[model samples]
Target: MHLIDLRTLQQFVRVAESESISRAAQALHISASPLSRTILNLEARIGFALFDRVGRSLRLNNAGRELLVNARALLRDNERLMLDLQRRAGGTGGTVVLGHMPGALYNGIIPDTARRVQAAHPSIRFQFESALESEQLEELRRGRFDLAVQTQDVSDPALASRVFASERYVLLMPRDHPLATTAEISLNALVEAEWVVTPERAGPSLRSAFTAACRRQGFEPRVACVAGDIVSALALVAHGFGLCVAQESLVRFSGEQILVRALPLLEMQTVYRIVWRVDGLTPAATRFLEALAAPSKAATPRGQRKR
Candidate 1:
């Protein structure tokens, strides 16, 4: 529905990327003046000044920076549309890009999830990347990635998610700690213990939750180490460096020295979910999600599972 021409948009992108009209013109095999005119024409069409020009030097203004993202997305979608057409005409397999946080790969969760999806849709292949939640959401919005699988949710209305699994958080520590032998322990008892938790930027507000739980127990957690991910946090715990609170799902990666214990007082839970843009999903993405949507066996009751 946009009125701007693709050619003009491409020219604007080239100029914006090069930061010089002459350079972009040379790269595009055209004279600088016409290329500059194309940019002006685009600005006119969009009704905004995209660049700040001072004595032949060009810098992207705020409007330009904002437009650049959408422009690049348009160009990318155009490329993807062509590929889609070609793939459809040939009756071949399609590709979907998946973004996830780090812990998924550590315990082989993402692969297991993909295999579960692939069981029903064998023709759809997946590509994966580990990225921050913000970056994952941005790329998913931009059509760079088709879906995101993470433990955290964002407030953006354009994105939607389905719960894949919910795993209760547990404390990870070496086997020989004094309270480690205890069947149950509270956060207050561990307040004096050194702990390892993920930094805020890496994933969810895990450390914040842990700290809040500690505060409710009348003290803040002593974070001896801030790990980049749950895997590294567990690794630190295995080496007897400190205790770590992690998801029960991570028990798959636990070593002989590592013990997973439920924390009654932290009162935390994490859900692994599949997130996608609610609009404009490609066939591959939709099909993969539909496969994932198939119902699973009923969950066992906590009382029965323990027995």
Candidate 2:
């Protein structure tokens, strides 16, 4: 048998983990043909097919299953060696792949946290990725990312998530809108206005909360357009497309054109959490999380909340 080729071995490992050649190629940032060729070459050298095809899907063969177990161990050792070398050369200078919901990134928390982490640990690199919450969880499960910041709990009960901050939700509208002058508009009043919302998958809990709140108000919301991110939501509001409900942290990005206020009838809030695979955290990921865990000294004063 030909000796193991680490490059081909690595590709095979990714394919096995993702169970889809196309997905593996996308995650590795390579074309499908090249990834397929690598796998074919490795299988040919070993004189046995590594995967069994079933319709449009593939499953590892017995030999492939055995190789995968060893392959993962080898990959881990390889990573350890690289990390050690990097540490010796300088310090913790490696990319920490982070996935966050689109809404969080536009609201400045992700950028601010990333800046602070970089300032504290210059050598630690970051790859900030914006995605839907479901996509984030899937990537985290597939070993594509180091960490994820999300506003809702994923359906998976085993994944570990830590609460980073608790922020209250508020309604946003145009400055001259009738509801803008009220200290707190009732949810029933919101029912008469068109609503802009985040994707359901990204903010399922928030969606549920909003829907339930509307039920309590005796009418369902008239959804206008579902903006994919917070910035888009704010943009829609600025254009008078629809009113939006968002977290108080969103106020950081609000411009003079938009107005924010509390909803007297809707007191629901969202707890933003940092999630990651318990077993897949890298050294940089650990350090960044430690920084996030650090107590915030810049919090708003107790008696005053952001308007």
Candidate 3:
């Protein structure tokens, strides 16, 4: 038997799974011609046809089905070897990519946590991107991230996550609004109040909680405007457009003219979780998540006073 190269084997697997060389090449970040050549070479080594050419598509042959099983095992081994090599070269000094929801960024934890990671691991670099909860989870499954912080309930048993903190939704109104004077307000009283809300997908769990609270009070929120995220929603409150229910993370950006009061009747809470892949994490990624769990310093804007 001819020697089988791992790279060629991996390309074959991608092509089989995607069922198209174009898609496989795109996923592997290579052009179609080189990928096609690699697959041909792999077939030559195996001495059997892996795929049958149809009019415009390629269908996996019986041999392809058998090879795919071994291909996956080999690819997994390669990944393990790469992870081991990365850790051995540097214990906790590399790039750690993190995904988080926009609300988490406003909660002050994102920056505070990142700052902590920098302090503890000076040589480690960090990148954080705001994404929807589902998108973050999907990317984590694809092995595209080192960590993710989101404000939704992750029910997937295959993934590992820990709740770093819980944030309650506070009623935000214009400073001069009649409802702003109360120390706390009941959700029942805001039945007719025009409200601004975040995107539904960004906080599905929280949205369900808020809707249920409204239903219990015999009313649904009169959504006057739907903002892109918490920041935009709060900005609407600042401009006297309407009231909004924002997480504690948004407390940092609410203007001075906006009043934040606790909602006594509603049981809306957002949990910020630090999630990573179920497989073993690199030393650098592990250290970064540890810092995220325990913020090393208080997070405050450069020119703002603590609330």
The alpha-carbon deviation from the true structure for residue 128 of candidate 2, after best TM-score superposition, in angstroms, is: 0.8
Top of the candidates by TM-score: 3
Rank list by lDDT: 2, 1, 3
Summarize candidate 2's per-residue lDDT along 189-291 as a digit string, tens digits: 7778889876665345456678777787688889998886667888989888778887776676768788878766767776778998887777777777877
For candidate 1, the 10 contiguous residues with the lowest summed lDDT are 298-307
**Steric overlap count per candidate:** 0, 0, 2
- For residues 1-307, what per-residue lDDT tens digits would candidate 1 score against the true structure? 4588788888989999999999999999999999978888778877889999987778999999998999999999999889767764443347789998766554444565567656765666789998877788889999899899777666789988877766677777888877778766754568778888888654466776677777777887787888877778878888887898876656766777887776777778767788998896777677667656655442211211110
Q: How much is the lDDT of residue 189 in candidate 3?
A: 62
For model 1, the superposed segments whose C-alpha errors exceed 4 Å read 1-92, 105-110, 152-154, 297-307
Clashing pairs in 1: none
lDDT of 3: 0.75
Q: What's the C-alpha lDDT at position 242 in model 3?
A: 87
TM-score head-to-head 1 vs 3, winner: 3
Model 2 local distance difference test score: 0.77
> Candidate 1: what lDDT?
0.76
Q: Rate the local accuracy (lDDT) of all candidates.
A: 0.76, 0.77, 0.75
Which regions of candidate 2 deviate over 4 angstroms?
1-84, 88-91, 106-109, 154-158, 199-208, 225-228, 298-306
